[model samples]
Target: MRLTFLGTGSAMPTGTRAQSGYLLRHGDETLLVDCGSGVLNALARTDVGYEGVDTVVLTHHHLDHVSDLAVLLKARWLAGETDLTVVGPPGTSDLVEETLAVHEYMQGRLDLTLRDRTTGTFDLAGFTIESMAVRHSMQCFAYRLQPADGGPSVVLSGDTEAFPELIEFADGAAVLVHDCSFPDDVDVSNHPTPTTLGEALAAAEAELGRVYLTHLYPHTEGRHEEMLASLADHYDGQVTFAEDGLTVRVED
Candidate 1:
């Protein structure tokens, strides 16, 4: 399985990074997660075109997470690729309907399916997806994707605060992509700092293979080294900071 970071920045766009988005490709299936602002443009920057995305899994309905959803759908509709599936927690269908309603021009032209799920495992495009609720200001989720054909699994932590459940969700996975929004010294709510995330990982008492940090904010601009050092203090594991267009493969 290959994971591509489309946009790794937070709500605000930086000169280097965009908002939160990712593309996961396994075999011939492509699943896009979190179509935030600039996500379509970022996807265009990659080899995958808008028409190649057949499945979309959203973690939450925050603007930074779902901002590009309508645009992607519109583009796909224009390209005549209307067969699509979007899965997320409860309220996903409602949000889509509301978004389309706001943009009446594209309301009746899209043909897609919407699934609203909470905590369970389901099959999609030959992959088993497991979702778990995470601590956030809004209803959010973290996903674990296991290939049905048997290979290394991948876990993605959406916008969340440091929580032990997330560690368990990522246990034994080949790759664990988590949200590290700020540095240790910054006082923020509903987002993980390196120290808190490291402590939570340590408490889980499980082997989470490799950690990739994403969803960075401006406060974390010059504090990458300090954050990594703080994270190392509580948990010693391989960790990499995510960047837009970064691609990683999980080996079985």
Candidate 2:
């Protein structure tokens, strides 16, 4: 399984990183994890097209996470693609319904499937997805995806606060794409700090092979080394500060 970091920035975008977006690919199946602002353009930068993306899974309804959703739907509709499936939290269906309501042109042009689930496991094409609700300001979820053919598993922490449950959810994952939004001393509530992340990983029952820190804000600028140092104090593992367009292949 291959995971691509389409956007690595936080709610606030930086010059280099876009907002929250990730693309997972297994064979011919492509799953877009989050469709935040600039994600369509980012996907265009890759070999994928908006019309080719048949499945989308969102963690929450935050604008930074779902800003370009309607745009993508419209583009696909215009491209004569009618079938699409959207999976997310409770409000996911409402979000899409409201979006399509505003754009009457694409009303009957596209066949949209909305699945609103919380804290469960489901199958999406060749992937088995396990979802758990995380501690966030809103109703948010973290996803653990495993290939049906017994390939590597990846866990994506959408936008969340530091909690041990998150570690458990990410247990045994080849890659834990966590939301490390700030440094330890930054004192943010709804996001994770390096210290908190290390603590959680240390207490986790499963050994995470690698960790990729994403959803960074400007406060994290020039502090990557500092964050690494802090994380090293608790968890001794391979870690990388994710950047846009960074592709990571998961191995079992």
Consecutive 10-residue window with the lowest summed lDDT within model 1: 103-112
What are the runs in model 1 whose C-alpha is more than 4 Å off?
Answer: none
Q: List the residue pairs that clash in candidate 2.
A: none
Query: Residue by residue across 1-252, what tens digits does model 1's lDDT show?
Result: 888999999997777887889998888888898999988998987777888997899999999999999889988888999777899999998988888888877766878799899888999877889998999999999999988888999999999998887898788899999999999778899999999999998899678788999999988887888899999999999998988899999875
Model 2: residues with Cα > 4 Å off, grouped in runs: none
Q: Lowest summed-lDDT stretch of 10 residues in model 2?
A: 103-112
How accurate locally is residue 68 in candidate 2, as Cα lDDT from 0 to 100?
85
- TM-score of candidate 1 against the unseen true structure: 0.97
- TM-score for each of the candidates: 0.97, 0.97
